[model samples]
Target: MKIVIAGGHGKIALRLTRQLAGRGDSVLGIVRNPRHVADVERAGGEAVVLDLEHAGVDEVAATLAGADVAVFSAGSGNAATAARRDRMDRAAVVLVMDAAEQAGVRRFLHVSSINVGCADDPGIGEGYAVYLQAKRAAEQHIFDRDKLDWTVLRPGVLADGDGDGTVELTAGNPIAPKRARFDQVAREDVAAVLVELIDRPGTAGRIYVVVGGDTPIEKAIDV
Candidate 1:
């Protein structure tokens, strides 16, 4: 499989890239910073520098051409501002949706948040509220597309740890836990699910909520 990942420098994206490329798949990582090129390449993927915030459709579409799948994993890094949220979270997804359609890359996997519209509890921070709103808008855009085969993944409170090859998954407008105590999940585990999703054709057009669980990763998500 040939895959393109936006925000290839991200923690989760790096893990996903390493897994995909390690398995002999051709992978291209979109990185905005030149400094991050080595990081992606070290993870066993080629890198392309393009700032999606300013790039035109044809420009972005050119990069996605000939790809089998596109993953939207980009975001404004730790900037608690509404502008950054809409620009990176919402506009980036919309841009790629257009580019994917133009490039004829139908299979898409979006890295959405577990906080997005989670019972509409108004989220925590000012930026988080904006981020969730952007995620909803972006996810809606993907869901509305007639030509796209897409899946949105909502993973809870990401942590850094080795993959356990296990996850708890729920589909379609899932309710977040009120206590939020059991939401912690490893980034590597999430990456495992992503690769699994890539190989699972039955997962198209579904939205999933993910977390750590006793079930094996392969069995966690019901097709």
Candidate 2:
């Protein structure tokens, strides 16, 4: 399948790109930084430098045209202000949705944070609150798209260690423990779940929360 991944330079996106490309599927990663092009290519996927925050729907649609699936995995970095969060996390998703519909690409995979509900948490700080709010808004937009076959994956706090290939995947929000460890999942594990979702179109239109657990990757994705 031909696939396009937004935020191609992201850790999870890079992992997903390599997995898809390794299987001989055509993959193109859309990145804002020109320097990241070589990284995507080294991962065995083509790259297109386009900043989704400023790019118009037509321009994004042109890149998405003829693509079988589009994945939105971009995020504003740690130093992001509230305005940047809204633009990159919320509006950018809307732009991609419009472009995907216009390009006639029905299958879309979106990455969201498991803490999206924190938008309503009074204890959360302003910057983090806005980020969660933006993610929630983006999720609603994807859920509302009738023309798209969408799967939203909300992962808990991401970690850097290699994946154990086991996860606890459940519908809606799973019970997150007080300790962050229960929620700490490896990036590669999240990427592995995405690969399964990409191959299983029958599992579309559902939202899943993934974290480290005892279930095997393949079995956890039996949605």
Worst 10 residues of 2 by lDDT: 173-182
Query: Model 1, range 179-208, lDDT digits (tens) per residue?
Result: 323388899999999998889878998888
Cα lDDT tens digits, model 2, 1-223, are 9999999999999999988999999999999999999999999999999999899999999999999999999999889988899999999999998999999999999999888866767777677778888998998888789999999898988998789999999886322222222278899999999999998998789889898899999999775
Q: What is the model-wide C-alpha lDDT for candidate 1? A: 0.86
Query: Distance from true position, residue 102, model 2, in Å?
Result: 0.4
Per-model CA lDDT versus the true structure: 0.86, 0.89
Question: Which has the greatest lDDT?
Answer: 2
> Superposing every Cα of model 1 onto the true structure, what RMSD results?
2.0
